[model samples]
Target: MKAIFSWLNKPYYFNPKPLYKLKISIYHGLFIFLFLYIFRPFYLHEFDEIILPYTIGIGITAFVATFLILYLPALIFKDYFSEDNWTIGRNLLLMFVGVTFIGVALWYFGEIYKEPYNLRKINLLQFLSYTFLVSLIPLTFFVFLNEKNIRLRREKKVKEIRELKKVQELNNTEKLTKEVSITSENGKEKISFCIDNLVYVTSQGNYASFFIKKDDKINEKILRVTLAKIIAKLEKYPTIIRCHKSYIVNTNYITDISGNARGYLLKSKVIEIDIPVSRSFSKQSLLRLIS
Candidate 1:
């Protein structure tokens, strides 16, 4: 049964398609036919004339009929059981009863014709032996086949849920890294900035503008506080180092600090903005940038 399960799981490794599913079914079917042929065994001894032809014909027709009979249900019921959103016990009971009815149908048909093929002429011992070999073998194979599909579907669903959880976790982490702010009478107030996002604060008389970093994007927001007040408020944050009287910069964003006669340039952003770094503050800003 474990080998059967392994083969079914990797059908492509065995035969690329379900057409080849007949291979396993027919192999098992032939085994049952041979077992019954030896045990309860049909005898051509009763047919004196053309008995060989009769046996050959019966063998071919029975092989074809039994192949379609037992194998079709195995494939079809395995497919149905793959949709297993129902009780396993109920499905198993239904399958058992259905296969039992098939065995009874074979007995009924055998009984309809007298003597030659009449099941009534057959002794109880032979009938029971034949029924066990023909019916029970195929029925047991189908039960195992159905269970394999059920297990495969369960494994697939578990894998899909795990992948969904991974995607959801990634989305949550991305959401946390995005800046969210509120605009009110107090001016734009940021609840948080991604640790790597601070850029520079610029004066606009009584108001100040905060420049923040994004993914190759720059966002600026006007705050109600003056640049001096902004500097005082951010003083405790060691990264906020004054570049000029009008600008308090997040020194972490200072890629290069270039100084010339006219003024100093802060060269992190696309546009190299000139900042009038005072003699007193320039030294401190440069030291902070290197640190």
Candidate 2:
């Protein structure tokens, strides 16, 4: 039971690629069509009197319903459906909602074809229950496939970061000798330091705070500048990269990285606090830190 709960809360992928969506939709439609033909539920066999039309109608309706349920909201709510916060439970919810919608569509279409010749037919509720039952296999299959994909991606990324860390460690010797300069937004205040001395930069509202490592101690220098404004200037120093909306960090100063599914938490040797690599920027930040 504990393991099941952990799996439910584990991170999962959503809003798959367009080609994958289309392929899945097609398979769903075909599965529905095949199930209908084999089971002949709700007097569908009687519809064999005019089988061609009903067959086409069922196939097309299933295809369109699956496509809309799976693809439309992804485009509309692109930012809301990020992989960082998506969980297995959320994905299951999405699948259940999709199955419900597909059931509703099929119920509506089946109503149209219910002829006076045969008044014997299942009600909407029963049809929907049937849909849910029929849908279980495919949804479960996808959950496993998607989880495997995430595991594969994480493994490859971890390997890439490991190799890059080795190269950067060697290059960091020269990087420590260079000096970096940053100025305030109004151009009134400025600070300069050797690359090794700077630990991280954080901003709140319009004030940016620079955390500097000196004599094995952490010191802070504040400047009246937004993080966005200061970030461009810091780019000249390759080790300094923005990891989140509120923070920029020197990758060379990062002592440990926690690979949480939501984001990467960075711990620095000189700084006591944990810096975050946000969902929106984690991929790019990792790329920057690695290369």
Candidate 3:
């Protein structure tokens, strides 16, 4: 029952789920109507004396029963379905059984209302068996739809994952100018940093900070991507200057560069950070910082 509801409620982005439910409900109602109408002659043969009234009552019951039969299991299993595959199968099974039960019930209702209503006279087992067989048509249809839904969901997920990977790859590619390798004393991890998107790299006691540009804004992420390894990575880019032992600056965004024996300054409207240029790299760093 839970599975049946889940299959029915599978998400469809463009078409709201309620609209789909309404569409399916109407179709089921019509299907039940046709099934009853087609078998009206057989019902009449057994209850000829009160056929008119019996037919009217059965029609009304069938109409209401069709939607109830479809909705009941949906309400019951509203939360039980968790897995996608099971949800699809359960929904189909519930609908199949619901329709079969309603059809058989309508048959019994017609017979019971007639003039010589002999409760013991009818073959209840045979009626149930026949109804079960008849329900296979709609059951098959529901199964087909369920399979299709699963395939579409899988495809959609695959597409979304592929797009996310591309975005991550592009971000990595843009930082290509900085080629820094990272190694941990724990020896569990080692990797390289691509410098294209790098805004700045900062050092902590035993860790490093990697600030990269994402959506035109800088976000600081800690990487085992060490400061020394990061310097090794940026070796190819001469413009990259070590401003401080603790800080490295991408000179591309440097607006003003000034320093004496104390430290160096780099300024932009959004940021102002001092770059400490060591005696060894001070000349080169100062030249890049100014240029």
Candidate 4:
């Protein structure tokens, strides 16, 4: 019973496309029509007739009514039944109750109309049982097929996103491999390092402090250059992003990001100190870190 409920409660089981719903309804109508036409389940004793046509008609009408009934709520409360917000158990149970009630009501009225003033021939228990049984088959099939399609689409989208990320990461890694030269404004003093080893640069009044990783330790080198000049020179490197007025960091070293009332702070795995991320640069810093 639990397994059955789980299967029925899968995503997209209740909410399917209108075309798919129409196709399922048509399939259901055909199944019921054929079943009753061949078996002749209900009998009218007074008329001494097998109510085959009426049974088939009632089955198709009940399912069509059920489909329309389900559609109204979905249309009115779109967000409630949206993919992210959907509650499988609640939605499926409501749908089951609704379809069953509609099916039973159709069967009841169908019997009364076929045999007016002849209540004895109309067995409510038998009518309900048959209605529920017929309803169950088509509903189960529709849910299974809808859930399978949804799962396949979700998996395909996830795979595509992962592949795209892999390609971007590869390109970023290739860019990081190149060496960059930083020179002082006077053009007399210059320093060069592989983009990967450069951790960060901090402004220190008239000079800029460059922190580069060598032999697993951070080596600080002070050059006679302004932060503005360094920023202009390193603007071509995508991974090296400026996070604050006094600080520019290589995103490859960022381990964590935390925010407070003041603003955001970025932590680097290679550096012992935490870098302040200004409100102006916070959004761009995060985007570069992730990208």
Most accurate candidate by TM-score: 2
- What lDDT would candidate 2 get against the real structure? 0.75
Name the regions of candidate 4 deviating beyond 4 angstroms: 1-10, 13-20, 42-52, 116-120, 137-169, 172-291
lDDT of each: 0.51, 0.75, 0.56, 0.67
The lDDT, on a scale of 0 to 1, for candidate 4 is 0.67
lDDT of 1 by residue, 70-174 (tens): 456556766443321223343445445544544454444444433464423665456556666666667557656655565465445434544543454232122
Q: Give the count of colliding residue pairs in each prediction.
A: 0, 0, 12, 0
**Deviation in angstroms for 272 in model 2?**
8.6
Candidate RMSDs in Å, in order, are 25.3, 5.2, 20.6, 15.9
Give the poorly placed runs of model 2, Cα more than 4 Å off. Answer: 16-27, 30-43, 71-80, 116-120, 160-169, 176-230, 242-248, 255-291
Worst 10 residues of 4 by lDDT: 282-291
lDDT measured at residue 207 in model 4 versus the true structure, 0 to 100: 88
Ranking by TM-score: 2, 4, 3, 1
